[model samples]
Target chain A: MDRVSLIDRVSQGMKNLLVLMLVLLTGCAQQQLRGTGDLGVVIERAAGRIVVVDSSAHATLGTVEGLGDLSHASVVFSRDGRYAYVFGRDGGITKVDLLTQNIARRVVQAGNSIGGAISQDGRLVVAQNYEPGGIKVFDAETLELLADIPSTFGNNGQRSKVVGLADLPGNRFAYALFEAGEIWVADLSDPKHPQLTKYCDIGRQPYDGLVTPDGRYYLAGLFGEDGIALVDLWKPEQGARKILAHYGRGEEKLPVFKMPHLRGWAVAGGRAYLPAVGRHEVLVVDTSTWQEVGRISVKGQPVFVMARPDARQVWVNFAFPDNGWVQVIDTLDNRLIDTLAPGKAVLHLEFTPKGEQVWISARDDNRVMIYDTLTRKPVGELPAQSPSGIFFTSRAGRIGF
Target chain B: MKSLCLLMCFSLAMQASAQSTAEPTPARQHELIRLVRQDCGSCHGMTLKGGLGLPLLPDSLRDKPASSLAATVVHGRPGTAMPPWKTILAEGEAEWIVSRLLTGFPKE
Candidate 1:
């Protein structure tokens, strides 16, 4: 070949190489996130929008808007994964249709309903009215207030700090009081008039609690004790049993850590993982034995804990300074696999019922992050306003009020 | 008697030299200016206008006593994020910094 022809060929090859490099760089830059189920993971962006991405990690799905800012909202998917119910800390409860990606209806509830959890039947949505230390039952269909259970148990004046809520079979709900150090079991059998059956004291100011799959026992995190107390529901009179103490690995033999500040926990595969904020470590407790099996240290003040049951992987949210990243841990190996930087104050992560994907709330950035569960890659970003809490839908298309 | 008198004279001269060295000089003033621009300016703004901390300029701390300001710098106010600097800074250095903060300039 002539020299000029050879030079032209080389130039073309270089252009192709450059293109390939660009493609490779873009592919490398994209993060791997898991989806909760067959439906793409839906993330509530703090920017008052929602983004949905499918499981294959291909195709950017859609963007929806109209969630308020600074609300620290929590989104729960309906049973069929059709609609997302958003409850904000600043009194904004919105129903977003996942199919259309639109805010169907918005209503202002009482002050600072930061989080809400729907029952298995999806008829009642129980919201924690933060300031008053109580749970407000709203008609899941009408979004109307049905009942309010106040912190009327003890002499403690302020409303008990109600941080989390979980649904049990039937119309029963277990709510955690962050300040009052008690867990109240309520029967919403009659949605209009919910009754608090009994109170089990956990420890000094219990922050949150997690129940096992069998629903026989509840583990509560003591913000003060540097440990968690186990509650046996079958025997409520036994009170909360202080099971595992101090991250399972402290030289002092006593609780040297001043404030354990347990913020988030995940229970699966007969093991419970609680992120102790003051200790800056994740404590893994075996549910069957009721003992702390292991501990993993991470960055400052981890607040939200999540795990994929099939994958044996756990993710934790560090509330400040790199707020949107999660520390991934391999439970089988009991080692930190990687630090997932999702960007912008990721305060919550929830898996779909099928556990195919995970939805994340980018609280400060106002968006939700959808990740593919298997690859753990970012598939999409959803717009939301200060979205913090997340739950799955009751049904594919059911947009709860 | 002669040796004692010579020792006393030498001690007096040494004390005078020490006082002279301790006295704030123009070089020390320049150093304080550098510190104000580098250390104090970072948190309190380029003009010593406070952001998270109290303002260091004369207009912001107009009637505030130098002693109180010095005390604050040496022993940070408790129940807040401010940390005590007694461990970090020496007594004289703290006093100098506080004096500069209060007067809006170094002791010149």
Candidate 2:
């Protein structure tokens, strides 16, 4: 070959090799996703970082840092559970690659945000904002802003604070307005052109809410009212109805030291176990009938009431002063079976997919505690900094995690 | 005699306020600063502008009496999400927070 022809040929050969390498890398990435769903991320709140934990292996991987304002941070995993979309209080949405323990794409989506949800189809991600209150949707993969729906209720030109945003079937998002006392369903089937169905007068001051695991109901716990506001997403025309009206009604209640998070409602044995605000108890609701079935008295004001994967038992945490304890309730007999003091301040709980074990984050102790749910004994621990929320990727497939 | 008793009661109340708002030590002050900026910042905004809770900016709190603000921190606002911090914070610490909040919270 002539010298010039040889040079051109070599360059072309290199280009072809690059193309093949890229194709191979993409294939490997697809293969790696199969095991990624077993991964989990722990929120190092005081510090802007997350410690990736391998749930199946029960080991700490690495820490991804520099995501801002995680004081009240929460995370939702991607459909494949490879990427963790971290929602920061400073209105930042960060997409982190669990395998690499690095931030893949990060964006300050809003001014201030509490939490967010991923659509069932995994095509869209929506964040519920507190400032200039509204919901903003973005492309799941690219984090591109697709739609913006402000929480302007009734004739008011101003937006109201939004809360309790959760993902639903049919590419829809459900959230409550704290000031407007309303619930809005954002239909994102189109992704670009979104439609909203409003359920007005949904009790009052919905501090937080969540969708049932079966994706049939959306319940918001009211701060302004005594009971929970429920919506039958299957029947959007009926709007919302108040259930457990007299749950805490007319009773002399303790001063709520902290707002009980309603998102942690645990569904086990065909019943919903929710922490009652200002009450040292968990309200058991029959999901089929939507009736108040019973109440299980816990150690203190309940914070997180979570069910083991097998739905045989439920775990409960508490607000400050009583925040250092974790209580487990038996689903079969519906009684408090055990109580474990994980550490100084037991903040969050997460169970491995098959319910073989569970992880708990204790903020004061600055460590993650693992317990064998079945054995009811201490298993392991991973050191972290001011950890508050622990999220397992198994949650990606579950509704309203 | 009655007038003197009332004056003495007023002086004692003033002393309590003064004692509670007594400037914290530099180390304790740093912890207090974080408490307002992180724990309280969870809802009030890291910069204290506002989020789920209303703004705690100097401008927003300038009009609010420091005593009332201190009381809110100590006793908490009933019928609202603001919980009583008496469990974690002392009366004086709350007073200190009120004073700092009124005069622009420290960034650090």
Candidate 3:
């Protein structure tokens, strides 16, 4: 062996060390996301925190704190499924890392905000606000203000309460102006400067709206009347059209204790199961015809009419007095088949990805209950401080989630 | 000193008025407290700071008359999200709520 042989051997050793370093770096990057969509988060309202749960094992992972005013909290998952963006009732938007069970970034974007949506491209986050009435868009990465679209109504520069905010395909957002009786769409492809389009006469007092699974249509619920406004995203020129024209015609409206959250309503089996406000019934609408096909009589005023992931059954919960009861409607027959007494003040329910089980939050009971959808039996329970909403990360890939 | 005297007198007057009004049963008072803290707190921040609805903090209600506040709670404002509690709360109970709210809501 000579000097030349010694130098060649040293170069080979250095190359092997560099290759080993690359392999270790790749392993560290992969370990960052230790969890998957099988995990879920339950909103503990009074505690102002969220309890992360393992949906598969029906076990608690950990709890994240410092979330303010979660009484009407809602959450949306990041594209990678490793983070959840929680929208608090007090206009606080928090970016939580689900893998680590911690808050990554958080911001108070408004004085009062109901809920928000993440852009389809996963680059922008927009919150629909009540105070000063507008939608605030933020950078998904840093929670920085990206754009502001005020919901200006009338001629006096008056802003109206914006509701029914849902993200549409093509990087756009659609929501209703409760005071203006109008629906607006903002194209946020540019994020910084959004192009606006408005439909002035879409009936009265649109409370909430949701986009279809394919992101083709947006349905806005009305409070001032008995109808819903539909907007076709494929053809925005047609504007919003009213459905259920005579839904409650000639019938006197009962006093509504709490306005039903339309976000919980579902479109399944080519039909829509929406709670009829002020009525103890769930109106079944044909998705294609947009006509009321049937109605399922419930125990009380249904607040959340959610369908199973397979669209086979629809579970309904009510407001106040009737809240303690949970009603299930078989989609095949469109009738109430089973009524289960979960606990006191059953506020929300969430089905697993393939609809195997559902996690329920009983605020009065101060616990989260998981039940097998097939057997309708209790599986597990996690103690919480006044839980109101339960969200699973499997929603990351679903449209109009 | 004069302003301080007036403030003390006003506080006593309000307290006397609250006592004179219909005093809820211990159970009913407990129920009302839970309802306001949880149900009403859903929209109006749990801490009563502010949320979808405006704050019900004593500082904000201090300027307003207690009678009007009680009336608003019972009858609710028209054309707003606030629903009338007439079905659930009696007029006297609303007055009691107003009295306690003007000072400070009971945590328990």
Candidate 4:
């Protein structure tokens, strides 16, 4: 053969070898293509780590560490459910990749933080800090600082610890100040020039806040008083109004072991199920009228009154001495139906995407218990180190998760 | 013989004083550390740098009187979210927690 033809044959052979090597490399690496919808993270608070688990398989995939002070950790997922942005107690924001089960990016943005929220369009991640109280917004992709809106109040312009930060439509955020007793709605459409609407004197010490599932109403739970401050997103000119203003009136308040969380306010059957502060009862209010409709007596001071996906049943967890027990409330009848002892110090509960199973994190027991929603029996268990929060990818599609 | 008797008396006095102070057992101390790091950590923060509550770090608490801190832990501060721990802790245990807070809390 001529020299030119021989060179052509050699180049063709090299191309064939390259294709074969590519196939072998992919196969040998054992890279499995999968979706992240069934994946979730369990916050190991004491260990400052997160265990990524697959709900469909009931198995842990991998563990990611180096997250500092996850004692009050909360997580929000990317729109695609491929990433989890964990907000740590020490103001560390960690972005973990669900597919790779590793940290994508991490930043300690503040001295202290309570929780955080992702903007409506999923372009911004906001952390509410407690040290120099304010909400710092960041670019979701790079975790770069986009804006810093200090929660300044009072005559001296002292910053107040921000709480109950939630996302609204059109790239806006609604949060309450625990020390200032004020609620502020920030329009971050133009992250740099944020248009802020402040509502003052909402109540004394509004400990936490939450936005309705529809993103139309913002509610702040008062710690210093006996009511909830409600703001209609559509009607900002009217300001906030107090609902259930006399919830604990005429009754001596019991010592609250833990502050009831308002973030998980249950809305089922057109009624909102809320935990009455310092009371062993769940208050039901008509969402349309924002009026008290009923109250169900529970085992202890309810910490999380969360509704199942279908809104047919609500699960309630307690604080302190009663934390070991979990109760089920039938929303149709508005009555306590069943109670089960999951484990010691049950810290949190999360329902599956379809609400077939519920995961309960028992911190002291160092395990997470999964129970069938219909049968109300323990179906599975996963060991963890002081797990506090269980977040599923399904939250990625929900508003105000 | 006289010196031995005096040594015995001194040892007895030390034991009596230690009993009066009522230091918790090692196991109980472990539980207390976990409780303060996790439960009280809910408000004061896990590292005790504070969240909704004031910082429990040694520097922040050193200036405060140990007895007052213990009393606050046992009886809780009225009109605030701080609830009385008397239901779960005794006076001595509260004092022990206060002392630990003043000198840096232990890790779990």
Write down the C-alpha DockQ for each prediction: 0.04, 0.39, 0.31, 0.65
Tens-digit per-residue lDDT, A192-232, candidate 1: 76767555566675655665555567666665555676767
User: Candidate 1, residue A257: CA error in Å?
Assistant: 15
Candidate 1 stretches greater than 4 Å from native: A1-46, A52-64, A156-158, A246-265, A322-325, A339-401, B1-108
Q: Write the per-residue lDDT of candidate 2 for residues A21-102, one digit (tens) a residue.
A: 9999997986564478678899988788988988877788889999898877888889888899999988999999988788
TM-score of each: 0.62, 0.87, 0.87, 0.92
TM-score winner, 1 or 2: 2
The CAPRI category of model 3 is acceptable
Q: Distance (Å) between predicted and true CA of B68, model 1? A: 14
Question: In model 2, which regions exceed 4 Å deviation?
Answer: A1-34, B1-38, B45-47, B86-90, B104-108
True contacts kept of each: 0.00, 0.59, 0.41, 0.83
- Tens-place lDDT digits, model 2, residues B50-83: 7777889888887778889899988888767787
Candidate 1: Cα lDDT at A356:
70
Q: Compared with the true structure, what per-residue lDDT tens digits does model 3 show for residues A1-401?
A: 99999999999999999999999999788566455779888998878899988888878888999988787789988888878999987789999987777789999987778889888988888999888699999999999999999999889999988998988888899999988999999999998889999998898888889888888888888888888899888988888899987888898666566678777558899999988977888999998999999988899988888989889999998887788999888899887888988899999999998998988889889998888998888888888888889988888777677
Worst 10-residue lDDT window for candidate 4 chain A reads: A26-35
TM-score of every candidate's chain A: 0.73, 0.91, 0.91, 0.94
Check candidate 2 and list the clashing pairs: B20-B92
Interface RMSD of each: 12.2, 2.3, 2.3, 0.8
The local distance difference test score of each candidate is: 0.62, 0.85, 0.85, 0.92
Model 2's DockQ?
0.39
Tens digits of lDDT, candidate 1, B22-60: 434556557656545434432343345442234577887
Instruction: Give the root-mean-square deviation of each candidate in angstroms.
Output: 15.5, 6.8, 8.5, 5.6
